[model samples]
Target: MSSGHTAVTTALQPCGLPEHRNCGIREVLDRIGDKWSVLVIAELSPGTRRFREIQRGIHGISQRMLTLTLRRLERDGLVLRTAFPTVPVTVTYQLTDRGRSLTHLVQQLADWSLANMAAVAESRRRWDAANPESMIV
Candidate 1:
C-alpha cells in the first residue's frame, strides 16, 4: 500500500471513492510485496520448474516458505500449477501471463539491490562507527 503503484486506476473512478479505494490491487500488491514471491516468480520465468528446482535455484528459501508462497501465487492467478499424470505424479509451477509481466519490474529491483548494496553497507558502517553509544562498550 505504501507504493504508489498500489493506487486504484482511473478506470475505477466510476466506483466512487470508498469502493475505488478498496480495489483489487491491494491483494495483488500484498501477494507480490514479499521478496521471496518476486524471486520465486522470476525463477519460474525461464520455464515450468518443479518445486525442488525452484527451491534449489533460490538460496535461503525454506521448503515451507516455498510451498506457501507458491500456493499464494497460484491462488492469485500469477502462477499455474500442473500435476503430471505419471506414475509418481510430478508437479510443476510456471508463471501465468500476468506473472510474466512482472519479471522486468522484479528483475530491475533485484539488480538495483545488487548494485546499491555496497554503498548502503558503507553508509550503515559509517553510522555504526560514529554512534558508539549503541554498541557494547
Candidate 2:
C-alpha cells in the first residue's frame, strides 16, 4: 500500500480455451515430459525389471535421478513397485495397466524422435552457422 501502488487484476479466459485453463493433456505431459521418464518407460515396456536391471538398461542416468523418476511414475499410478524380503531386500518396477497404455504413446514419440533427429540436428546446425553469435561455448 506504499508509493501509491495499486494491485491490478485481469479476467481469466474461458476454461474451454487452452490459454485460460490447465489442459488435461498438459497435466499428463507435465508428469512424464522429462527425457528420463520416456527412457525409463521404454526400458520397462518389455516386462517387469528390478531396480538394478532398469538402471543398467538405461545408460547415463544417475541413481538419484532414476529413483526420483520412478517415484514420480509410481505416484501417478503409471508404475507399480514391489519389494521382496531377502538378505538385502530386492525391489522391482513394472508398468501398471495405465502405464502399459502410455508405453504405446511414448513409443510413437521415440519413433518420431529417431526419424527426425537428423533433421532437427541439421536445422540447429544451420541456425548456428547463420548466427554464430548465438552459439554458446
Candidate 3:
C-alpha cells in the first residue's frame, strides 16, 4: 500500500485492532454517513429549526423519517433537541458542539462532491458504457 494510505489506515485504527473491530469510526460513520443524517445536520447547521421547518427544507423526507432521524441524531449526541410547553408543543433542534465540529468536515465533503460532480458523472458514464453487464440498475 502507499505510505499515505498506510498512514491514514493507521490513524483510523489507533486501537491497533483490525478495521472491522474498530467500532468507534464504524459506528459513528454508520450514523452520520447515512443519506438523511448529513442533510439533517446541514439543515440544522444554520441554527435551530423546528420539526416542520426541517421537514420542509429536506425534500422527499417523510415526517416519520424526519422524526427517526432527529431521534437518532439526538441519541448520538450530535444534536440537541429542546422542547417548549405550548398549546401543543414546540420542539427545536440544533447541533451540539461535537456536531458543530463535524459540520466543518461535512461541509468540506459537500463542497468536494459539488466540485467533482461532473467529473464523477463522466467517469461513471464511461465505466457503465464499458461494463454494461456489471451495472446493477
Candidate 4:
C-alpha cells in the first residue's frame, strides 16, 4: 500500500466491515439498494400517500411490486403502513422518523447521480469502445 493510502481496518463503519461481520451491512444495503425502495421512499418523503398515489408517483412500477416494496420497508421499520377502516379498506404509507432521516441521504444520492451521469456515461462509452470483446448482448 502507498504511504498516503492507509490500509483499512474493520471498524464497524459502513463501506468498511470485517469480512465475517458483513451481514449487517449487507442486509441494510439489500433494503436500500433495490431500485423500488428509494423511489417509494422518495414518494413518501413529502407526506403520507395512498397506495395508488405512491404507485402513480413512481412510473412503471407494478402494483404487486409496490406492495412488496412497501411491505419490506414496513418490515424494516422505515415506513409506517396504516390501514383505515372504511367501506373499502384504505391503506396509506408514510415515512417513520427513521425513514424521514433517510430523505437527505437519498436526495444527496440523487444529486450525485445527476452530477456524474454524463461523466459515467462517457466512461462507459469509452470502456465499451475499447473493450468490445468484454461487452455482453
Candidate 5:
C-alpha cells in the first residue's frame, strides 16, 4: 500500500489495525468532498425542494449532473427522495437525519470560507504572482 493509504489506515485504526483493502473514510470522503454534493446538501438544508428548485438554486449544474448527484446522495442515505404520481411525476428532495448531520459540517465550512475569503484570495494572488508559470488560466 502507498504511504498515504497506510497513513490513513493507521490513523483510522490506531488500535488493533486490521488489514483494510478499502476504507470507509475514503468512500465517505469521496462522496461528500465532491463539488456538487456539499452544495446539494447545503441547498437541501433549508427544507424539501423540487427538482427545478434544486437546479435553480445551484447555478451552473446541468440537469444530468443534478440528477446523478441526487441519486448518489439518496443511495448513500444522506438525502430522502420522494416522488409523487402527478401529471409530470413530481419529485422532491429533503435531507435525512444523516444528511442533516453532514449539513451542519458543510455549513461550518461554508461559514469559514466566507469569513476567510479575502485572506484566501490574497494568498492565492500572492501565490499566483510568485508562480506565474503554474497558473492554469
Candidate 6:
C-alpha cells in the first residue's frame, strides 16, 4: 500500500481480474502463460488486425477463446480496439506500445514451438518403438 507504486501496480496487475493495486512485470508473464493467450498473442503480434484476420491466423482456436483473449488484453491495456465509422462498423485490434514490446518474446516462443514439435515427434516415435505394448490404449 505504499504510495509510489500504487498507480503502476494498478496498471500492471494482470492476474485474474487485476485490481488497481501493486503488481509487477512478473504478473504479466503469469497472465500470458495460458496456451490460448500465448497463441492469441502470437497470432496478433505482427500487426493490427480485424477479428476475421486473427481467426484466420490462429489455426483451430475457437471463436469464444479469441473473443475472451481480446477482451483480457484490452483490459490489461495491452491491446487497442478501434471501431471504424463504417456501414457495418468495422473493428480492429492492435497492440498498444506495451503489447508491441512483447512481440519478440512471443515470436521467440513461436519459433521454439516450431522447433520443439519436430523433436517431440521424433521422441514420440522413439518412445513408441520401445514401448509398443503400451499403445493398446
Instruction: Score every model by TM-score.
Output: 0.77, 0.81, 0.84, 0.82, 0.83, 0.68
lDDT of 4 by residue, 83-124 (tens): 999989988889999999999999998899999999999998
Question: Residues 2-102, candidate 3, lDDT per residue (tens digit)?
Answer: 76654443453444476556567767788999989999999999999999999999999999999999999999999999999997888899999988988
Candidates' C-alpha lDDT:
0.88, 0.89, 0.89, 0.90, 0.90, 0.81
Q: Candidate 2's error at 95, in angstroms?
A: 0.2
| Candidate 5 residue 55 C-alpha distance from true site, Å | 0.9
lDDT for position 95 in model 5: 96
Colliding residue pairs in candidate 6? none
lDDT of 6: 0.81
What global local distance difference test value does model 1 have? 0.88
- Comparing 4 and 5 by TM-score, which wins? 5
State in Å the error of residue 112, model 4.
0.5
Model 6 stretches with alpha carbons more than 4 Å out: 1-27, 125-137
Candidate 2: the clashing residue pairs are: none
Better of 3 and 6 by TM-score: 3
**lDDT value for candidate 2?**
0.89
TM-score for candidate 1: 0.77
Q: Give the candidates in order of lDDT, highest first.
A: 4, 5, 3, 2, 1, 6
Tens-digit lDDT track for model 5 on 3-114?
Answer: 6653443444522247654546768888999989999999999999999999999999999999999999999999999989999898899999999999779989999989
Question: What TM-score does model 6 achieve against the real structure?
Answer: 0.68
lDDT per residue as tens, model 6, 1-137: 67665455355344345473465656776677777778777777778889999989888888998999889988988889999999999999988898888779888987888989999889888888889888543
For candidate 2, lDDT tens digit of each residue in 1-137?
68798675875444568575765766677778888888899999999999889999999999999999999999999899999999799899999999999898998998999999999999989888989988453
The candidate with the higher lDDT, 1 or 4, is 4
* Candidate 4 lDDT: 0.90
